[model samples]
Target: MASRTAIKRLTVEYKRLQTQPPPYIVAKPLESNLFEWHYILTGPPDSPYEGGEYHGRIVFPNTYPYAPPAIRMITPSGRFATDTRLCLSMSDFHPDSWNPMWSVPTILTGLLSFMLEDTQTTGSIVTTAAQKRQYS
Candidate 1:
């Protein structure tokens, strides 16, 4: 179970993001569960992911806020591994590198940008990087 502090922090941060969406991103809870959220992020127009409205989920742990949340794209945005949970700087993906100072909005931006890179690493998801750069 999350401590009261974690819960309160998440509640406030979540509401803040919901009330003021960053021009390109919109996220909301998938259900009243509160632990699971669904987001639709539009990629930067000039970029390959541009014109794409990516769908994904963010799962907060019991220690959320104190610990980063896990983010995974459900639509296979061509950046992350297919159906594979992403390995992010935040989230359980790479806890060692996550910064607690990060808010929900910051995390979302980082996640989207990070995936835009061609990591050139095996474990990383190699999107249809070759499919002619089309947006979804």
Candidate 2:
């Protein structure tokens, strides 16, 4: 059972996405359970992820807003591990590291920006030099 606040938050987020969608963010639940959201995000133009749309999922705990949700990419983004959980500074990767002030919009914005980076991890696809050329 979800608390009123959590339900309201989900509703508000859902409505906001419907009107003015994000340039690189499209999210939906894995099932009828609105708490789990799967997303597809495109990298900003001219970045390593340029012209690419990556897929991931955000699992919001029933006690969400109080605790940051867990985020993982189901599809291969080449930026993050595919299927394996990530260790983002703000993710439940380290629940104690979460910040209360952070919101969905902020997280989404960070995600859009982060994919441009080539992290020091295996299974991450380095955007080809040719791809970077068209990023202009």
Report the number of the highest-TM-score candidate: 1
The positional error of residue 121 in candidate 1, measured at the CA in angstroms, is 5.4
Runs of candidate 1 with Cα error greater than 4 angstroms are 120-123, 127-132
Tell me how far the alpha carbon of residue 39 in candidate 2 is from the true structure, in angstroms, after superposition.
0.6
Q: With candidate 1 superimposed using the best TM-score fit, by how many Å does residue 100's alpha carbon deviate from the native?
A: 1.5
lDDT (Cα, 0-100) at 107 in candidate 2: 70
Which lDDT tens digits does candidate 1 get at residues 23-126?
A: 67888766676778888888787777777788888888878766778777777666765545677777677788878888778878877777677765333655
Full-model lDDT, candidate 1: 0.73
Residues 30-58 of candidate 2 have per-residue lDDT tens digits of 56888888787876665666667778888
Off by over 4 Å in 2: 119-136
Worst 10 residues of 1 by lDDT: 120-129
Give the TM-score of each candidate. Answer: 0.85, 0.79
